[model samples]
Target chain A: MKQGPLDLSQHFLEEGVVDLSSSEKQSALEELCAITSKHAHVRDAKAFCKAIFEREKLVSTGIGLGVAIPHVKIPSVTDYVITVGRSEAGIDFDAIDGQPVRLVFMIAASEKQTAEFVRVLASIVKLVKQNDVRSRLLEASMPNEFCSILREASR
Target chain B: MNARTLVDHIRSSAATGRLLILCVIIGAIAGVFCVAFSWLLETVQYYLLDGLAHHESEHPVWIWLLVLPAFGGLVSGVLTTKFAPEAAGPGTDAAVDAYHHHGGRVRTRVPFIKMITAAVTLGTGGSAGREGPLTQIGGGIGSFVATGLRLSNQERRILMAAGMAAGIGAMFHAPLAGALFAAEILYREMDLEHEVIVPSFIASIIAYSIYAQKAGWEPVYAAPHFHFRNALQLLAYAALAIVLAASATLFTRLWRVVRDAFSSLPVPTALKPAIGGLIAGSIGVFVPDALGTGHHLLAGAFASSFSIGFLILLVTAKMVTTSLTIGSGASGGKLGPSLVLGGSLGSIVGLVVQDLFPSLEIDAGAFVVVGMAGFFAAAANTPISTIIMVSELTGNYQLLVPSMLVCVLAYLFVSRHGIYDAQLVSRLEAPSKMGNMLGAVLKTIAIRDAANHTRDLIVVPEAMSLRQIIDLYTSSEQLAFPMVDPDGKLTGMIEGRDIRRAIAEEGVADLVVARDLARPHEVIDIESTLLDAVQRMTLTGLEDLILVEAEDPTRPVGVLEHQEVLHAYDRKLMEK
Candidate 1:
């Protein structure tokens, strides 16, 4: 299957809503769970969060250049999915640039799709390097606008 | 010519013309040094062996085993401590430090110290390569020349690169590889402007030509040619690349381990090298091929005559010798020893695989060359330079594809953890905080403070006429003013945009107060962090942000913008 920005939406964004804040971590986690439970096949948002947290403990997914790519390989999904989220308020993810992350791409993939998942992740990194595309995504106001901006960028 | 005249002459020459001349000078100088360095080393070897070649009948191998390394270690220790301290150990770090921080200037005395010390170290059988010292020598020459000419920082950097290329070309007689090494490995980037490329190429070619004339052009290695008979062999080649990458990592780790161990010791610094030499010589007693640079042994491996067991022994011995020699504080290059060790590993792998699958006709030597480049790329993180170096040294462009593939694979494998630990620390020290803060402060002081001071001085009745507000901007530098309606609420802000756009397009100067140019979202709350303020600016793509009191949303506190933050940080750094 040809995976693109839609796959990212399904994997990263929990529901139709994404929460962004500076001082509160729990609110962000709760919002992530609410969104995932609505859009994701896995009904347990807590388990998904646990897996992502474990991955983060291994190495900060905040690769330099103001980007954070957090991923997990979970048995709950039979296929791979990726999602992107923007926080205009900026979250402290311990990024290499010492700058808080404004964009997050969360990925969930099955063991069988490891190579394909990695290839897609590399492509996403390349895509985000475009200054204009990143700026447009950061400025997106709502879920519909965010999705539209991602779709146009991928195209 | 006088120094000033010489500097002026160099500066006036077209970039290409100056580079060509510099390259020729570097090449000639490097070639002479290489020949002298080689001869001096051979003399030490002869004295240590008592004028007897390897197969001499009566000479006790034990005498060579004991005396040579002891002498090498002691000499290296004394030379390093007494003379050029910067020339101690492997030359790579010195080059990197000079390039990044020293404005591409190395002391002229460094090359002389390196040549003498390296020759003595290699001569008595110090387990290191000559190439590293030669690179330092070349780099030093470039630095000295540029400094003498008083060149601009950019020009000096290019000249230093050119000198390094010339040195590599002279030492290896690989011109193209030398040029690429300068642009790729030394710089750590492939994107080069005309200014860098022109000089680098000229220097490499000149160095190669001079060395070739003196040495009569020796190929790095000679091998029997073989063609792939089936697609399965390509798979074998891919497998070879994977193994090479892993081995490269091991080599890099071993070097680090030895360096750390020696450096952690409490002994007097000068004596450390002697101890390393003693250990290397003890190892050399069992494996005689580990004595010098191992060029002869590398040549032997390509002939399919070196046994797999012997190759393994050589690899271990060379690794220990090189690590100890360099780790302890000997002045030398890691490039030659790394290539030799990596080539031996590949050759052994090829021999074992061919033996198991007797039907497959594969030349192990071809794998050796590819392994050399692959290992260098992985260890050094310079794939382009390694690829080009291998192709140029062997004069075999046909191996480019395999070389490139192997190099890239090896590079990726090693990069997961990374080879250079120091680079990670340095990269973390970017000027991000200072830059951002300075940008913010500058914007505030330049625009906001001036406006606020004017507002305090200029007082008008609540029902100010449009003519008076226009007169305020006309009489002073405050082009914009916040207008408060009679109810003490800030109704709007007026600026040049409204007046100029009206005058230019509508052709009317009907005057208005600050309320005319006020946009709905021009104000920000006071409680936000500086990061928030910066993001708002970034998102709106605006030059300024108007600050309003949080308790009273309509009342203006002050304005903050890009320049305010920048100026503050700039002043802070200047004071420091």
Candidate 2:
């Protein structure tokens, strides 16, 4: 899925949020919302969690390769937004393996953006599976750098 | 104090805050303890075997074989009976049971007892590998640290994995393999985050460095330089994968047969290993290289000293010895022994192939290395770790492609199962019919008492109302409920949180029934294996399951809870 740089960048990054160490799902949802708001058009955390859970119910989205793609089709989200969060401290996402999740990619897309959304997801999966690309993405210093890496990896 | 104050106080209590810190400290302590245990065992084995090898240098190797194995078996039998009975069998099953059922709580003394007992077993020339005891020792150390630090159940489980990694790394001097070993073999997938990989790497490297510094580096096997000409050889390697896969299946089946046979015996359990040892010892008399863990024979094969005929004999003898040793209840490992056996088998195969086609020369040692990785991958169903391990062991990065191919093929070939059937069984949703039969026999013999006790006491009536469910929950302390419709059709489930949420949000007096709030989720089928249950639970993050008739999910038969299963397993261990 190839999307413009600005759109793809907005899909995955949020700025100025400190690292979270909380184990509660609500706290994680709040953190996710905060980060996602800076990138996409998310109204609130609850709506995001509901959308993600609905998607989860349809399919685990765990993907089984240590990566989980939690996305939502919500009208509140204006554009296709993907937010990537790395938990230095692991969070229990009820991951398929009963193991805590470290890296999370949350996708927010409108109903009309099916093809683009799928392509973006496929690109992310392919990039994440590559050791070099994932390492660079994980080590990106700021929102801009993270966005740049994602754009570069997508290409 | 008010309710808010009490809740805050409980959250900030010294006990709760310390649990997280305890987990980290436990991980570090466990790492150190695993190294110490491994070193201790190795030292004992070295000294004991050093004397025997020296004394037998002047005589025929056959005499030393009989004496060494007999002595090892006797010592193993005596130590198992006198001290730690738990140390008598492969430690992986115990570790797995403890992890799932005991909240990673293992007796601190178990590692020490296992270290000494396993050392005696190996030192006396028992035909078992050391990896099993190492895992138990590592797990015990992890438990010790967790208990000492008072970590939470979740953190303790992580520490258990870290400890296992450390032990495997130290034992084999393969840090990457050790780390992956913990993540892949025990967890059945790479569940830990990339961040945890750093700690696992650090622990494994530290432990392995300490071991290597003290013991010096010992190559797992030597390899003669072999040139790879074309993609054709890679195809040949792929063909060889079939052989490796078949061999791995045979090894696993043989091990199961031996275990089942011995467990079926009416005699005292303590005496079984002695009988096994006698069989292994007799084999060792004819094939001296089959004695002990056979690391020396592996080295010999790599150096091209062992002939094809001798390789055949060693492979057969080693397989039988290992099967008997483990079957008889001797606490040991199969990894090293399997590698040796696979290597020998590969060498023999390579020789026969080369003899048939003299023009197409193939290096036997190279085939041996490929065989080692392929067999391990097939038997363990861990292809990535197997490929990486063989590459690292041989220090031949060039072999990675062939190794990967063979490992993957072998894994595909044995896609049906693994040598560690208990591990596979544990991952299932319910025990198989064979497992049920075994469980029944164990119960009849009163051996089931040692297993962990699970209290699956909560039951829900088909006609219960939502108000009644709420009242029952408020009156009692149960956390889960099985919801059945008026006609006794399995509908869904309601948990403590579900009821509380419904009451808080919708009002308890709204006349909403349990059926209205019940969440219809997938019910675990009766025929589903225990491993399947665990995997599904893990995937869904469900703590309780509704057991329904296999033919129909609408018919509710019983309820199963994660805690109850864990308790039942604990009872099993206690009985043991």
Candidate achieving the largest TM-score: 1
lDDT of 1 by residue, B203-231 (tens): 77777777777677766664436334555
lDDT of 2 by residue, A1-155 (tens): 22332234433444532345565444665576567756536665567667566555433555433455666655566777666666666677665575666567767776444334445555566666677876675677666776677766666
Task: Let me know the DockQ for model 1.
Answer: 0.01
TM-score of chain A of 2: 0.71
True contacts kept of 2: 0.00
The C-alpha RMSD of each candidate to the native structure, in angstroms, is 26.2, 28.1
For candidate 2, write residues B1-576 as lDDT tens digits: 999999889877765445444434544555566556656666766676556553224353555556665566666667776777767777766775676567777787778777776776666567777776777777777777767778777557666766666677777767788777765664333223232354456556766666666656764554637545557677578778888888888888888898899899897776777777777777867665666777766666766667887787777778888888877887678788878877887777777666775556677778788888888888877777778888767766667787888988888888556765435332333222246544543333221222121244355653354567778888865667776645766656765655665444322222234434455455776555445555576787666666665578786555555665566555655776
Candidate 1 chain B worst ten-residue window by lDDT? B504-513
How far off is residue B398 in model 2, in Å? 1.5
The best candidate by lDDT is: 1
| Per-model TM against the reference | 0.58, 0.55
* Clashing pairs counted in every model: 29, 40
lDDT of residue B209 for candidate 1? 74
lDDT of 2: 0.65
